[model samples]
Target: MNFKHLSTSVIGLLVLSACQQPVVHIYHEGLSDTQRFQLKQQLEQQQINYEFTELATPDKYNTPHLLYFPGDVTEAYIQNVERIVKGLGFDRFDSQVFSHTGHYYTKGNLGLYFPSAYSERVLPELLFAHNCGDQDFQIHIKTNGQWTAMNSPIDLKGLDLKWEFYETFFKLRRYFDDGTFQQQVYQIKQHQVRTLQGYKPAVTYEVLGHRDYSFSLFNCDLQAIFAD
Candidate 1:
């Protein structure tokens, strides 16, 4: 091999590799000193190129930390950064992408919001499904003296229930061929619980209502509930 040509090829590969590397800018406020040290160590361990700038004032975004990346970055880079920050005891962080044109946009952003250390307790959520097979049914939940209709694979988070101690009454209406609905009601108590992770379904309640139809509840992981 010609030595001159080999040297030129090595230089070209190095340039390409450097261009592909992602540079991350971390803006943080309200982070303890130990947390900051751990974050830096994690970033260095991952060989991630990063810069830390302490915000003189509280972050306008109103979050503990924010990770800003270039618009051309990839998902792998984003995940690595998220894993590092979350490992540092920050359960929640927001991320955004900045264009080369100096404009910020939310397109293709993760927009993840997890429960942080600030929250005293995680409110239990309800997730339920029916064993009626192909039969279509309507569900409504009444809490604090108000009733609202709901859909199956029911999640109480979307129902906007008050974050306090209360009893939720579920109404299940299963339609039959006779143009009538077989209705049943279920009562479940709700409260908050302290958890290492975020809020999850407290318990799986198997409600045996009508002879032909019944529904059961189960705990769902955060990923399953938040999957796009």
Candidate 2:
């Protein structure tokens, strides 16, 4: 074993590892001055390379408070970044992973929309819009007090609802063709909807003559249950 050759190989591996670490570019759009300062300070303390950048335009989705990573990034890097952000009272949602952006690269950089404020203090609200293709349904909401029947969209304000720092807990009922209803409980970010268990299992369904029917079920919508 040549000592020089061994040393060179170790150095090359170290360089490659360093290069693989993503450089975080935090977009400070809705963040306050103090929040921005604290975020940078925390990143520096963690020895993570990061820089502040202006908010990019054409964000048609209107999601200015999410952390966007490269589609091809390793899950480990994603978890590390999430842990760091969580320390600063930032909560992430699953939908945020698919944020659209024009900043694509071979070696992707991590981008964050660090908002100054979060909506955790606000009361949670539920909106049940019937979209099961005219299928009549019954809804129930579990609260700290008791299980209440929810006919229309009801505000959980001044009501005892099961909620956590970043998620709201509730149960959904799915009507089956066999004259049976199955209860499915879910804990999701506020303002997000979860399909009733086993709803829309496929992307599309073939119709006899009209066209391919897209599978979509907008059962309900919860609002103001997440941290910004």
Candidate 3:
């Protein structure tokens, strides 16, 4: 088979089709009236463009608790990938594709993701945006009866996040940056997009604790929070 002769769109379509995961439900238990109202208002006003996704509990059954501006990631990365797909006229995460400067929360380093997994390359430039600390999304959470906006959240201070939020550590351990890695992982597996179960958090306070960084929310039964 001449993969070299295949079209980029065809390759992209193949990868998209091969993706099979159940959809999870986004819960409202974490959001208060104010947060919900503010979120909706922001979307209507176009004041911000972001992706929001929360996971459910039990480590067996996962759900997406919420989502907003779903794929509205910084357009830089999207444009870069789209450009290459156009030039090569092929669209496989495989082969020799170069990802240009893109953005997650903002424009930073670009990366290349090869289908072979082994050939996936992460140049120094791609790690630039993640070499620093976290400045969480402009979202709010209610803890102790107060609605606080998480513009630049503090680690180990999980605040109002439920158990499922903690599980993200292990579920998508592929990358761990300030908080970008976990957040991106959650967004990709959004409940509104697919139906899947719990993958669990494997990060702890030792050994690979460097990744755990400032998050200390896994100390309790995240699922039990909903149970009680």
Candidate 4:
């Protein structure tokens, strides 16, 4: 082994690594100044765990990059911009974390996703779904600053309703073609209880609605906030 040659090669590799920058590229030209600042703050504070270069040009490049998406674009935007990239046979990371996880469950928009919860008189609830022994979804409400998690709330089993395409405030579902039809047992006391990690304090930011369904932050944690 030539020690001098190996030392020179190590320095060369360090130089090459230092020169390459991974950028968070913003493609949406319509972003307002406030929105841009908010996105940057969110990424820096909670989302990104590494340093990055912020790029904003439309030029083609050979550097490694990921597209910074605001998670509010239409499906057509993917077909137009992203599809073109794929059509040219390029693969890249997209930062729209809520692409399919969930969306805002607005008030009065309750008709969109909470018809069943309302019908059972259990509209004000937090839903949690996970697979312990088969997929299980539980409902809870904050009562007197404590969670009324069990004790005969609107519990669902044999969940077989399926919706896929795009999620609107009207359809509050993530996966399709599963056995997810609405089956609820209201006002019955439940003996089984468990805790979900992501919905609690310090695990995720305590904002309500669509963000509760985000893939990155919530990730099968609290599926939806059904109340105002």
Please report the candidate that would top TM-score against the real structure: 2
Residue range 1-228, candidate 2, lDDT tens digits = 899999999999999978777676765554434455666887788777777876542343233433444454566656666666554434442224433444432344655654323322222332233433544233344445343334433333343333223233444444455766543343433222224431110111111122122322223333322333
Task: Give me the runs in candidate 3 sitting further than 4 Å from their true place.
Answer: 1-26, 47-228
List candidate 1 segments past 4 Å from native.
Answer: 1-3, 64-71, 99-228
Deviation in Å, model 4, residue 35 alpha carbon = 8.1
Q: On residues 21-134, what C-alpha lDDT tens digit does candidate 3 reach at each position?
A: 112122222333333354445443543333333422222112221111234334553454334322221222221222233212222212222111111110011110121234
Model 2 lDDT, full chain set: 0.44
Q: What total of clashing residue pairs does each candidate reach?
A: 0, 2, 19, 13
Candidate 1 lDDT, 35-68, residue by residue in tens: 5577778879988776664434322444443334
List per-prediction Cα lDDT, in the order shown. Answer: 0.43, 0.44, 0.27, 0.31
How much is 45 displaced in model 2, in angstroms?
2.8
Per-residue error at 98 for model 2, in Å? Answer: 5.9
TM for candidate 3 is: 0.16
Regions of model 4 farther than 4 Å from truth: 1-22, 26-37, 41-151, 165-167, 170-228
lDDT, model 1: 0.43
TM-score of 4: 0.20
